[model samples]
Target: GLAERKKVTHVAMESTGVYWKPVYNLLEAEPIEVLVVNAQHIKAVPGRKTDVKDAEWIADLLRHGLLKGSYIPHRAQRELRELVRYRR
Candidate 1:
């Protein structure tokens, strides 16, 4: 399935709560460029609150290079996250 998906050059996601780890991991494992953006940075205006449209908006911004990428640890650092979480 992963081979089917086109090679991703970058990833953009709205930074919500602490629920972004897995999402980050999935993308990071592919070794593609990743970006985590602030939700407020991409908040939609009135009458444009649909999920589909919101995703489209994010994609649009990413395409035009308007999205700001957040920090993602290197593979070693990411491994530490697993150890920290599992040990808890």
Candidate 2:
């Protein structure tokens, strides 16, 4: 995996609706700290606009421990919520 290849210890990603869920799930089991940051928070900090530039900015922020991760429920809780929704 890229993370293993790079020996990354932490990862930060912007929360964009439900898009971050799958990626988060994939990373959850890895031996790494995964931070799902709010898009609003990222936008609140002024930075470059291009995707490449945005990635660089995010990396810099993460490296400096400036990113804040949003709360994510445990896998069991998430599954329960999904079951309840399906039942409804």
Each model's TM-score, in the order given? 0.74, 0.87
Where is model 1 more than 4 Å wrong at Cα? Answer: 1-4, 78-88
Please give, for residues 1-88, the per-residue lDDT of candidate 2 as tens digits: 7778899899899999888999999999888999999988887656577878878888999999999899999999998998999999
C-alpha lDDT of residue 70 in model 2: 91
Query: Which portions of model 2 miss their true places by more than 4 Å?
Result: none
Best by lDDT: 2
For each candidate, what is the lDDT?
A: 0.80, 0.89
- lDDT of model number 1: 0.80
lDDT of 1 by residue, 1-88 (tens): 3523876677788889867778886777675667888888899456676889988888999999998877767878878988999999
